[model samples]
Target: MTADDQRTAADLLDAVGPAFGKLRRTALLEVDNPISAKDLSRTLVLNLVLEHSSHSEVTVGMIAELLGSDPSVASRMVSDTIKAGYLTRAASQQDGRRTILQLSDSGRDLMTRFRKHQRDAYDYITADWSEHDRLELARLLVRYVDSVAALKERSRTKEGDQ
Candidate 1:
């Protein structure tokens, strides 16, 4: 890309940071429970377990990698959730030595309610938008997230090769 094009792209991408920060703050304020950063991290881990537990194992190490957090921090978060009855640990069927994480009934319920709150919040925010525009925004946001994930993976691969 040309210099000006690169600069413009950087500027556009930079704006997304604050926009997401605002969205996160608003969502946290709307949630029934006061969630700390660690709690949010654990909740995301629960989300992953809910989504993928049937197909694969979810472990603390995997959560740490996904959250870009230290493994110890992830472990502590997992432990806290376990103590809260939001998650459970079981020996992995495929690997006896490895422990897998699963969401408890309460965790599932929490996630369900959280999802509704998020949808309601977004719907209210986009009340003036046409259905098509809302759909397009969702599509584009998913594309953006997938692209960024791919970029991160590629960067990690490059670092590993070095």
Candidate 2:
């Protein structure tokens, strides 16, 4: 809460920004299957679909809303994913006018590897932490993430009211 504490936190973030970039590069490089950064965006779209959708089916509109992307952008990414054999789309049974997307086997395989890389990254980041400290950090991180999400929601609501 003090000015010194605020400055130290800001300084830490500035110092860690490049470290975060390096870690992301390292993790992406560690993936078993090679995927270009450009291609990874579509893969991320498919991953979100798997994470949030039920029956393994997601609509373009749903993806757009979840990602805060335009419907056209989500549609294009879906098409790209399908072409890459990471996802497939079918006519929605509930609503014939809408399309539903499902992740293909390759997509699932990629996600598995991605998860492993993420675990490794987290492990590396916490290598020096004691068990108790690790647990406390995890708890704090969860709370921080939740608070940020709530703040984002409040900001959106405030914007809407203006």
Highest TM-score against the true fold, candidate: 1
Which portions of model 1 show Cα errors greater than 4 Å? 1-11, 31-41, 152-162
Best-fitting candidate, scored by lDDT: 1
Candidate 1 CA-lDDT value = 0.79
What TM-scores do the predictions have?
Answer: 0.75, 0.66
lDDT of 2 by residue, 67-89 (tens): 89899998898888889888888
Instruction: Estimate, for each residue in 36-57, the C-alpha lDDT of model 1 and write its tens digit.
Output: 5655656777877786688789
The TM-score of predicted model 2 comes to 0.66
Candidate 2 whole-model C-alpha lDDT, 0 to 1: 0.75
